[model samples]
Target: MNGIELIVIAIAMYAVAYKLYGNFLIKRLEVNNSNPTPSHTMNDGVDYCPAKPPVLLGHHFASIAGAGPIVGPVIAAGFGWVPVYLWILFGAVFIGGVHDFSSIISSVRHQSKSIGFIIQTYIGESGKKLFLLFSWATLILVIAVFTIIVADTFTHIPSSGTSSILFILLAIAFGLAIYRFKVSLTIGTIVGVILLFLCIFAGNYFPIQLNALTWQLILFAYIFLASVTPVWILLQPRDYLNSFFLYALMIGGLVGVFFAAPSINIPAFSSFSLDKVGYLFPALFVTVACGAISGFHSLVGSGTTAKQLDKESDARLVGYGGMLIEGLLAVLSLTAVASMVNKEFIDILVNKGPVPAFSLGVARFLNAIPFLNISSEAGQTFSALAVSAFALTSLDTAARLARFMFQEFFEVKENPEKESIFQNRFVATGITVAIGAALTFSGQTMSIWPVFGSANQLLAALALLALTAWIAYLRKGILFVMIPMLFMFAVTLTSLGMLVITNYNSENYTLSVISLLLFLLAVSLGFKTYNVLVNGKETSRELI
Candidate 1:
């Protein structure tokens, strides 16, 4: 099949899903524009504030569509384009989009509560604690890995490093201008774009050359501060500003795909080999988790996006619509990798990192644009910076969510009269950063990340279950969420079991133990949720 055909088909699928299934979801959820969102009702400006749909959409997309989709699809291409494409198509429509859409609406309905707290409300108090701890740990691992990824990108390519620094400063300035100085969005955005261009040139001329470890330390410190600050002050404005770069990357790649008209050079399938890419059933599911269905999307949906949503109507656009867009990105990444890249480049991507593979493929695509005059080197650098922007945008959002999880874990709100040091935002964010930093430097994180797929999918299953419960409480049919939840639970559990066996055989008992514990926890929670569902009993008044 031709690469252009693949892209066209993928686009068609996404459009059809968005119009038909997405509309179905919006109708079924009974989204009402008349209802005031938590952002308006609880306008705190720090954590809760009404945001325009465009601005919130930028933040939502930037937060959820990280490098995971690119990396996962590129690597999973080992199983062939057919399997990956099929999963990305159907999974995004039936599973991922549903998960993201339901998560946001569910949280909005619950007054912008975190999924962990929602789990507690629908399940049990213990369920809440367990879910929060599990989610917090996962966020730490996510932060550590993404931190290292960005820092390593900067350490190797000093130009991107400089651009990233300038990018942050621009975000802060944009935040202050809009929030503090009352500047119009149009002016703030214009200035941000100009500064971003300057950032590119300035980075090329004067780059910051630091080792990966040093960059990691510096980034962790920045995250510590960004996490505790108000969302509008840093996270929202930064993400909104950084989104332009991502938008450019996506547009450029799409134009490249259209004009380049590349062919699918890679094999259609790998004959279903475990040694090559593991069993296709569970491994394929986990490997392609992000583009298809990611639990992390649920976190972002419920974490900050719900809090800032201006109206219930926007949830469809921001949640369901965002996942479909991400699915398209995954398709584009896979198309580029399979058609434009070679075996040697694939090996480097597998062994080193997926960034180079994506950059090179993007470079090839952009090379076809005659008027752009984009050289191979220039395209590679641009793609790298764009990917780095995605990772860096996600970093602080994850940290802030982790801080919220920490506060919930400590029951900080149970008694508003007394102050607890641990409940302080700074203290919570500090702990989150410290744990993530320690993990980043531990050297075990690289080994542990493989299990991340299972853990992440497990989280998604749990999120789906939570959403299912919420729908059940509303007395709506939950067949949509329930089917996916059962499938994900089985797939993730199987993947976790496989990881346990794989680790034990390799004598990596530490990871084996950790995976086993996670497996057990997921199973236990699954069982509890099942018991509640079957018995038709509500244990917590929080749900009512």
Candidate 2:
């Protein structure tokens, strides 16, 4: 298969899906901008504040993105480009789009609360607790995984470190300039984009070398601040700008694929069982979560994006369109590896990591363009740094989402006057990041990646179960939700069971036990959702 054909097919499918299937979701959700969203109803300036759809899309897309689309697809190419390709294309449209769009709408209807709240309303109080515990722990793993990824990126490509720091400082000023002050979006964005380009150029010229451990510590401290601060102050603006980096990369990559017309050297079907991940059946599904469907997207949609959504009408673009855009990225990531030979692919995957394989592969794609005049070394560095910067976006966003889960977990619903130390955002955030930081040293990044992927898919299953209950409450079509829910549950449970046995034999009891816990949580939630949908009283009520 040619990379260009893959790109073309992906683009067409994604566009059609966003429009046709997106309308189906809109009818079920029954949304309108005429109605006030949680962002307006519960405007708290910090976590809950209305944002323009474009800016929200940028932030939402960047948050759920990071390196997942690149790293996962690049690594999963080992299984076979064809399988990974098919899954990313159809799974993203049918499964991922539905999951993300419904999650946002569910949260919006419930005053932009987390998925735990949706479960609590449709399921039971106990179910909510289980889901929150499951969700919070999943988020911590996300933080740990991303922290290690970003740190390692910086350690190897020191230019990424310099670029990231520059981004942080620039994002702060950009946020205040456009949002706080009276600067027009046009003027502010113009200056901010120019500065962003300068940051990229500066990164290549002046690099700051640091070890992985030191980078990890610095990242922990940075996320601590990023989480506690207001959304617009740092995260929102930073991610908004970060989206441009990704958009440029995707566009350039597509153009490169067109010009290069690279024939895939890797087999369309390599083996049923991939080299490291063993079985392809469930491993490929879990490994490619972000590119296809991810539980983490639910967290971001409900935890942060729902809270900031300007209107119900914008949900389709931010939620549904975001997933399609990401699917395109996953296709590009796979194309990166498909263009390489088995020897080069294995060497990069085994030696460096997924990011570098994607980086080097994409650099070659760009090199095929005659007019741009990009060198291999410079293009590769740029690709790696861009990925690392987005990975940093995931690190802090996970911390904030984790903090939200922690605070919500401890809330005294019965007695509103009751107070606890856990209610304090700083305390909750500190505890969250502290725990994630601890896990960074617990295992190597590569060792942790597989478990992280499994746990993430498991979380998605639980989230889908919760979404099914919500759809039942709405008295809408539950078939769409139900199918994906069951399929992911089957895939995740089998994968986790495999991990439990695999890790236990390797004497990795910690990860083994963690996998078992995730398995238990999914089963518990599935039962709860089942009982609610079948045994509970009629759910049709005034909810909008």
Candidate 3:
């Protein structure tokens, strides 16, 4: 099949989903534009300030889109693009989109509480604690893995290092302009794009190469600060600005696939042997988590995006739209790799332990742009910078989410109670980043990616279960959410069981234990949440 055909079909499916299924969710959720959102009701300058849909879209998309779409599909391509493509297409529309949209709307309804709090309101206190713990661990893993991922990208490509620094500086400037000087969105976006391109130019002229360890330390410090700062100061504006690069890359990829019209060179289906890429049953589903459905989206959607949402109606756009776009990115990444990546480079990609495999795929896509003067090396560097931008957003956003969970853990109810030094945002953020940094420094993050994928999908299943409980509480239709939840539960639990066997064989007892624990937590939580949905009398009455 032609690569462009793949792109076209994916786009068509996403469009139909947005029009049909997305609208169905919005209506089902009863998104009332007249009702005040938490952002408007609370209006806390730090985390709860109301944001226009467009800006929120930028932040939501950038945060959730992180290297997952690129990295997951590229790694899963060993099973061939056909399976990956099918999963991305169907999974995003039916599973991921629903999960994200429900999480956001649920949070918005609950005054922008995290999914853990929503679980508490509808499920039980015990389920809430377990879900929050799961969510926190997932966010910390995100921080550790993404920090290493971005640091490795920067270390590998000096130009990306230079460009990443420039991107940060530009984001700060844009934030100051928009928030302090009250710059218009149009002008701010224009300035941001101009500065972004300038960063690319500056990157080539003044590259800053560093060792991987040094980059990791610096990134840890950067996220520590980024996490504590007010959202308007960095997180929102930075992600909004960084999103331009993502949009450009996605659009460029589609255009390249269309005009270049590359043929599918990779196999449509590889053997299901464990040696090649594990069994297609669980490994394929787990390895390709983000492109299809990821539980991490629930963390971002409830933990941050809900706080900034301006309208209840916008949840459909920001939540469902973001997943579809990420799915499109996954499709693009798979097409680029399947059609263009050389056989020899696959070994290098596996050995080198960075994102350059996808970078090289993106480079080929860029090279196909009509009349573009980009060299292979330059295209690779640019792609690296773009992916690093994604990693950067993911690391800090994950850090921010971690901080939220930490504070939530303490259950500090008021401003006076939160005055304790330990409750300070910096302290919370510092503690969160510290744990992730330790894991990253130990070089354990990469080894745990498979397990992380399982945990992530499991989180998605749990999130869906939570959503189903809430829908049941409201006496609303929940078959949509419940079906997807069951599917993900099966896929992820099987993946976790397989990981237990693999980890035991490899003598990685820690992961083995964690996998078993997660399996148990998921099953127990599933049984409890399902009972909450079934036994209506048992539903928690203390809720928003």
Candidate 1, residues 181-298, lDDT tens digits: the string is: 9899998888888888789999999999999888998999889888877898788988887778878888888889888899887778865754645888888888887778999999
Ranking by lDDT: 2, 1, 3
lDDT of 3 by residue, 420-457 (tens): 66667888888888899888878777777668888988
Better of 2 and 3 by lDDT: 2
A best-first ranking of the candidates according to their TM-score comes to 2, 1, 3
Clashes of each: 0, 0, 0
The superposed Cα distance between candidate 2 and the true structure at residue 284, in angstroms, equals 0.9
**Which ranges in model 1 have alpha carbons more than 4 Å from their true place?**
274-276, 341-352, 412-419, 537-544
Better of 1 and 3 by lDDT: 1
TM-score of each: 0.95, 0.96, 0.94
Model 2, residue pairs in steric clash: none
